[model samples]
Target: MIRLLEEMEQERRRMNELGQALLEQSIPLSEHDELLALSQKVDQLMMQLHYAKVEQTERQYVRGGTNFEAPSMV
Candidate 1:
């Protein structure tokens, strides 16, 4: 799990690099496809990290049940 987080962190760094390149106008139009692909990969990793953190927190919620409840329909 720690290894996974480390890898995700590295991927996030790469994503930032791509985004910065785009901002700096260093990336070519031909590379947009690859940049978009990397962006999606970064999104996926972020979601994974988010889910893991949530799961870890839920394990220590302290209460007997859930911490969130869906809004009730009228």
Candidate 2:
């Protein structure tokens, strides 16, 4: 899970770099499309990482039998 999170962070950095580069330079038409696709890919990767973390947390909660109780206030 940590590895997945790291990978997702790396991809996000790459996406940011790409955006910066696009703003600083005039890229060709094909390069624009390619960068857009890469951005979309990064978005998808982030979503997958988020879901993986959520699932892992759920599994841990279930396996550990964690109990949640409301506190009583007088």
Candidate 3:
């Protein structure tokens, strides 16, 4: 669980770096294509982070046994 969260965080940091670089640099069209790929990677990382959170929640509930229940939004 910790490891997954760490990986997610690392990816997020990398994504942010790429985004800032894209904004600050005035590169060629070919380089923009590469930056676009990094943007897609960011999307994929976000999905991974979401799923990891869900799985971690489930694991926590299971470990807590019958005492656990999903929280009410209200």
For each candidate, the alpha-carbon lDDT, in order, equals 0.76, 0.77, 0.69
State the lDDT of candidate 3 residue by residue for 1-74, as single tens digits. 56656766776687677667766775443466665775676677667778987887888788884455688899
Give one clash count per candidate, in the order shown. 0, 0, 0
Clashes of 3: 0
**Stretches of model 2 off by over 4 angstroms after superposition:** 26-31, 65-74
Q: Listing every candidate in turn, what is its Cα RMSD in Å to the true structure after a full C-alpha superposition?
A: 5.9, 3.4, 4.6
Clashing pairs in 2: none
Candidate 3, residue 58: Cα displacement in angstroms equals 0.5
Residue 1 C-alpha lDDT in model 1: 54
What is residue 59's positional error in candidate 3, in angstroms? 1.2
For candidate 2, the 10 contiguous residues with the lowest summed lDDT are: 26-35
lDDT of 1 by residue, 35-72 (tens): 77877887888788889888877776755465566888
| Candidate 3 accuracy as lDDT | 0.69
Using all chains and alpha carbons, the TM-scores for the candidates as numbered come to 0.59, 0.66, 0.50
The local lDDT score (0 to 100) that residue 60 gets in candidate 3 is 78
RMSD of 2: 3.4
